[model samples]
Target: MKRKSLIITLLILGSILFANGWDVQEYPYDLYVYYIVTKAPEKYENLIGSSVVAVTSHRHGDFGNAFNSSCKSGVIEFLENEDFVIDKMDGIDSTFLSKSFIEKYFPEVLCADISVSKEDLSYIWENLSSKYVGFSDMKKRGLNKKKFNKIKNTSELKALFDKYMEDCHFDMKIREFTYYQETAYDEGCKKSKDQRDIYFEQETSNAYYVRFTSCVEANANYFTNLEAVGVIGRNKEFIILDARSNYGGSNYVQEKLQKILNLEKYKGTVIVLQDNWSTSSGEVWSIFGNEKSQFKTLLVGTHSGGMQNYDRSNTIKNDDLNIEISFGSKYLGKILPKNYLGEGKGYEPDIWATTETMASVLTGLGVDVTGITFQ
Candidate 1:
């Protein structure tokens, strides 16, 4: 009889604990809640309870998993009255709090103020003539800068920008204004590897192929690799520069490549290959080679990635959340051509061909590929 009574009592206690499970509070949960309430109160005031679930269930990155695992689990609970109650404590290390983790799990919270504002429109309008290179072109398309004053949000602003881009056939990938969000892991947790800047292959006696995987100046071999291409391909009748899948880096690297290749003095035809993955500075370099080169140049493959309008980025940090929001600060409008592509629209190729069909395509274009191989 006594054993039965004890079992019943334990069952009641277990039920109570389970019922009050969400009523518990911990430091990490408190910090998360505090950040949401303080930084983005208007956006998250109603969704605080749901955000707690998201934070707890988040398992995509290293920091999230470490902080939320059972080994480091602290009692967490949200109340209807907006009260945080603590029943147990298991502290999480502050080192695990990272900007990448917050960005991945809580993008809305991080970018709450990303919506377009009246001030933003006013500033763009005021600087349109002097700062925006596309100003005259956009106006020629019947897009009045004043119309932007009616934009209520980011979506509306983006729609207006998209319309202008489509009408002008500009690079739709370059935005007149943009918010940049970087979700990469912090430097401490990132893995390092040795990577080559460029790869060269002699396809035939008359033809050579050079693939630029990266144009980052940070790479110690960047200049050396470009110099090697200039030396090796100087005598080739046909030079194929493949920039497919290259993410791009510094503008100076592209400038260095241009100087090294010295296309103005070259006698051979230069074919610059690009795909949708060839983005930022890579796309710029490809476009320059095709449009600005002194020698005959052909841009092959699909459209190049078009995120090249913004030249610089600025960051705003939330110290409490330990998160940084990066935004495009410098617009490239002043220097880019009037017909330059917009954000989201990449550069169109002169010859459309994939890696598999490149050999056939070149042959069709009257280029001899009898002994040449495609990779």
Candidate 2:
């Protein structure tokens, strides 16, 4: 029990230390995991009777066309230097895209054509609460799986969604929303309210640090509220990277943010406080060694979730609902590497700290964080 208390004390202290301005850089580890993704168009058949279609994106199509050519294969031989590794992926957020085109492609079929009610087809997605009745549930309900087998093509699937929407008063909640324009990387960030006055005096640098506790489950809630979060810049001062929650957003967004922060060689600490829940983008941004700069990254928390998920596209056909399926495909080899010190563990922390340690570290700083808060 005493040992456990000691661990917690260190983490709390570490957090406080960061609230003040000090940098004790550390190393990151690598681990292996993979995610899958899929995409496709809806058809009338899928809606009326039932069917499942595997999907791909324009990215795969273009790349396959280019890479499949014998000439492209020859280029691969030359490019396969010992240091070179190939990994390509993009475009998987929510599946919903649009409905009109789906209907145009797929018209209603004879009632004899399919089984899953238009009600069962889309109700779960429209009302997130009805999720238990989702396609997965329909099979358990003993209605949907049997119905989908009859869906001969994508067009039929499309008609079903159109009718489903009209019947259940279901509007695609995702369709109406537009994604905000991503902020440019060069733009400065603002210090959070909690950090100021209590932590360090406001300081500015082109170099930046963002400490975080990666929580994959956070995505289930965080991504849903992204727009409301909005862009935050430093107050009446110059900060390069903002520290909001520090531990959210999809891996794709974080990957983009990492490259953006990599502008001009950075010499400062980019601390990310991680726990086992630190996954997806958290893992990628924490230990991506591809960058040229020697990042003064501090991993002061526990072993990070070293799961790296690669996505394979899944597309829905014959439905007005514009959702593409994404499932786990292959695992990217471990970014969280094993060492003589430890193996099959989470990412290593250079300046390891527990929650209690973090508290003490902050206490030692004797900061006057006027603008920061603990809650």
Candidate 3:
């Protein structure tokens, strides 16, 4: 009776500590500033006494529901209270490039098939082009201030933006909604229906393959699946981790994997397969295999989606705005500089290969490919 009572009390305390969402009082926007100041305060050490809004503008995806007008107003108010400057003309200038304005006047820009007049183009260039060109991905794509400022017309801007969009693996857009569909590297090899989150099989006598479809903490089999892989592949010469198209979930998965996969005892190479589709926690897993694991690790396939720089994401709700903003509590730049593949920049692999050519690539690396199929 006493044990049952203790368990119930603990459960209640846990629920209270981790409520559905953080109340408005526990504002994550402010907490993000505190975290940057205390935890990862290398380059951002000056932020200790600086205004929160200074750092906020430089970050991307810090606020989850940024489109909500009420939320935006609340955020602006919060920044203003913290002595952050807000130009009164900002709203007026941005009104011309808003979603409603674009839909009504320049709908063709939505489809990237628009040819606007010089006056309209110049207006857009003055208002939106600076922000777009300032994007990290755009800068990485060789779009510099000199080149962008020199552009005289809409055609050049469109051409540059289009090319950047095409070449950039990670979606980077200004005030535009982008959706990514996770795709499996090998569609023919269907995952076992019984084992949905993780699937493992001995591809060869010396090699074992494990595919992680999702890393969501809610998946009951996450830990067990990883434990099973550790037990089964203890003596295997090679362990292949396929994380293609895995758009990460919980860091709990990373913790569980670290404990289960005892790389120190296992004398074998761990090969992680990743692509541009593998992001966030998926990239975290790949980084663990390559940088954290005690075993010999090799990162294969193309660059991994770079979205693991920030972690410990928590949602904070604002009752006034009726909005929940999810923001990361920790910045990983100082902690994991090697894996700190910035926004829209993926982790480059040691061996780059596609799904079609992976087998040949591995074989060339002295990994036995006899009777080993990708499926």
Candidate 4:
């Protein structure tokens, strides 16, 4: 019995020395929680009681099979109060707290997903290093300082992401794909492509309408559809870039569209129609039209969904535990205005109008919008 115990002890020590042991240190959720607390302690200090405290308590302990099981239980307990934790969140282990932040605080403005591979790190690195406007206010929005400090450049960030990928896991929870979400995305794409008025069309001598949806410009259909909007904006007296249902994508859409439309020379009064659905680049375009457009511009609608910043994310999956950790490294807001505070609060519209009353409101502004509809 004594010889057998000695052999087991040596095996455990060897596993630890080789860094191949599945201990508390390797538990993605525990490490992630530790990263958040250590990195953004002040931001999340007050929200302590459940798994936040539990995970943070054992940051340095050896994580074996027993520890992982207990840690998962603790995390689930902490996530019980979060509004969006559907079905006990059995699949999630490390992303509970940040995911809560996404669902509760920045639901419309930001997106993060569980990834089990390192294939997308290069793309993530590119976005993180891009130019942003408001660089100082990142901490207020929960940017992890510890992780940010380690990644000073693109190469460093890539290396850090690679480090997280050392442990491979097949997260059953994350692997449980929801077909409904994909179906919705497909439907939205179809609707945006099929919508005819995204390109500018003359409805009257002084009034023009463009019911635009999405800023995802790679689609050939969108490029083909919106070409006419540029043709009319140069000579039209009034232009309406409708963005009531915009959800956002690349800013290239704005850059390309403005160039194609010759918006700088357009002498018309351009009015942007936005609402809560207008997010990310949608909000950016509205702000651009209102403050930077060469033509006279007016933004009409309710508060716009303000998710103008860019996010850098890392996804870690532990196949042994069947869990995944999707976390953000940085939140770059360089494109936003210097003093912009419209992240969660959204951007207040100059003329507050809902979908029902938008057409009437447009008509009142000397825009003979007889058949124009807002989406």
Candidate 5:
């Protein structure tokens, strides 16, 4: 009996060591969570209204490879009240990271903990060496510091706070200086100025025009910006609503705009050019407006991008670096399903406006585009 007890004790110790087994003395207890933000029920009225957060990092690891702290409890508690969701979040065990599907969507939030006597940074440095570029990367980033301060606004960062933390002046980690938000990268992916101009001018210019490329969210920006510009009568005097590139964006923005549009300035007729590319929020906007707008909705292009539902996301937990990790996304309901002229089935346009038709429409004067195509 005594021998068995000793064996069990050894096994427990072995498990702990093996789970986060590394020669380095300390490493943070990592946690990961990914979710999407669908609605802003008055509580979350700040951050960029409803958006999808896609957690893009994963490693083939077991579930509880590093659960040695109360961090998991802290995180779960934090996310309990937010407008976010976990795809399959259960308890701490299920909620934590391992070599599972969870990792596929979310990365293990790494906390680069390095207390004075704790000696965790060294261990973390060694453990993450393979993941990062080099140990110099850790050294340069002051990973050895117990706590690092970060200022969100650059002006704020420039206005240095005299107060100092334990690791304030620690050796600077070069090349490791970067804000943890998705700024330039995401913005770059948005539609270019030229593209927006063309779409705006052609669509709203009282003439017939079509959009070449578009994303659901980005296209939402395009449409809204175009309306703003149209209010000033700067670009397209009339817009050809071609959602061929629109997949969709914020639900509220689309719905609210429809109501506002029906009021004035355009109580007559409008031509909408679309195709199969219209998706997500784009399809919803197209369907709702066309079906219930005061203007004569003439769909000349194909059906819009077939978008049934939208996936919501958010960050429930972040790494030691204060970089949060997102959990699974909460899939939202379809704002418009049947409205998808060519989601999966096929897109059918009113005038069957194609490449040739578009050219001809642009050349001819704005009169009657009826029977323009041979059905």
Candidate 6:
């Protein structure tokens, strides 16, 4: 009777603590262990059973050393207790715990509309860990192993989402609205010459100029239309692609240009004008134009904006620290060659053209660039 009574009391206490949630500063190890096993994405599902404790120790140790040196003492002790190697915790960014990851693995969590902010996540971690006896007996409730395979395409995914949206009445953001805007821009660029900055010098009869402001689908369509109208054909001796101040968008436009135009057929000088504002997709396009073009494409103007590697990021709210942690998951490769670090060091120019000298450079090619603005 005494043993039974003690067990009951402990169970009640555990329930209460679970409802309250964890204080990460006080119970960091407990919180970390709970999240890494239960809440982390399926991609990291390998980190579930036996490796949970080690993974938790590794992440916490990394976090502690980087952000708070005071926690390093406690974190070190925890790692040692777990039999985890301290050296293995080197390159982990534990600040912004994966939000997209959770969404991908557990879409059901979205139906609850729970505000899982930094404070909320901490509270959840505390609550979950408080009631936890052992991982062996943990309930694997709603995690469907074949969730991704169920919906093969976007249409099927949309159908499933529609059912959920109707049942939940969740306020969905208009993400597809940009598609309509892109369509309108495409139509305008194709129909009206004034809509886009594309010109062929009839006086020189040998120079074709196109100042693409952005590397978008619309600009690609406009360039295609220009090609159809005989504006960028074999008649030209020189082609000036002014992408100066273009801060990038999609590289599909560049790909389309290479495909439809077949730049090699027109054995003219392909000059690409770029500046500090030419970045991201713009830099990518410049690199593609230089490498893919059979006729070596000349990169004119100053160095481009060097931000190369493309990655999708999620902003996680850290209320405790009063800062937002933007965590990037996927690492899309650099635009330039392996030697160049495109973050700070952009692509070097073959013929350097500044704001003052650009007009003269164009004029030297027997093409007047008086009214033409660097788009």
Which pairs of residues clash in candidate 6, taking residues 3 or more apart in a chain or in different chains?
A: 21-127, 22-126
**Ranking 1 against 6 by TM-score, winner:** 1
User: Judged by TM-score relative to the true structure, which candidate is superior, 2 or 3?
Assistant: 3
Tens digits of per-residue lDDT for model 6 on 41-143?
2332333321222221101111122221123333333322332221222233132222222233333333332222344334323432343221111233332
Q: What is the lDDT of residue 128 in candidate 5?
A: 33
Tens-place lDDT digits, model 4, residues 1-375 = 999999999999986644421112223554243312111123233333212322110001102121222243334333343311111112222222323333333333222243433333333323333422222233345444355554433344434433332111101122322100000111111111123113444466677776656666533444565556666566667777776556555555565656655545777776777765566665644345534555566778766655554432455554653444343344544446544444434566678677767778877888878676543
TM-score of each: 0.48, 0.31, 0.46, 0.46, 0.34, 0.41
Write down the TM-score for model 6. 0.41
Candidate 3 deviant stretches above 4 angstroms = 1-198, 259-264, 285-291, 312-326, 337-339, 368-375
Q: Model 4, residue 35: displacement in angstroms?
A: 40
For candidate 1, the TM-score is 0.48
Q: Stretches of candidate 6 above 4 Å error?
A: 1-204, 216-231, 284-287, 319-321, 327-330, 338-341, 365-371
Q: Please, what are the lDDT tens digits per residue for candidate 3 over residues 149-182?
A: 5555445555666654322222322223221212
Residue 295 shift from truth in candidate 1, angstroms? 0.8
In model 1, where do residues sit more than 4 Å from their true spots? 1-198, 217-219, 260-264, 284-287, 290-292, 319-324, 329-331, 337-339, 366-375
How far residue 56's Cα lies from its native spot in candidate 2, in Å, is 34
**Mind giving the per-residue lDDT tens digits that candidate 2 earns over 1-375?**
999999999988986644442111122224311111121223111121111111111111111111111122222222222111122123212111111212222222111133334453454334332332233322343444334445443345445443321111111212221111111111111111121111122232322222232224533433332221112211212122222223233454444444544553344445444443333344433333334324444444555433342322222322464333322323333332332112113366555544435434433433222443232
Clashes of 6: 2
In model 3, the worst 10-residue window by lDDT is 87-96
Better of 2 and 4 by TM-score: 4
Better of 4 and 5 by lDDT: 4
Decreasing lDDT order of the candidates: 1, 3, 4, 6, 5, 2
Question: Which stretches in model 4 have alpha-carbon errors above 4 Å?
Answer: 1-202, 217-219, 260-264, 284-287, 290-292, 311-316, 321-332
Residue-level lDDT of model 1, residues 52-131, one tens digit each, is 22221111111232232221122131232222211111231111223334454455543333355665566555654454
Where does candidate 5 stray beyond 4 Å? 1-199, 202-212, 215-224, 229-238, 251-256, 284-290, 309-334, 337-343, 361-375
What C-alpha lDDT, on a 0 to 100 scale, does residue 210 get in candidate 1? 63
Among all candidates shown, the one with the greatest TM-score = 1
- Determine which window of 10 residues in candidate 2 has minimal summed lDDT: 178-187
Error of 6 at 292 (Å): 2.2
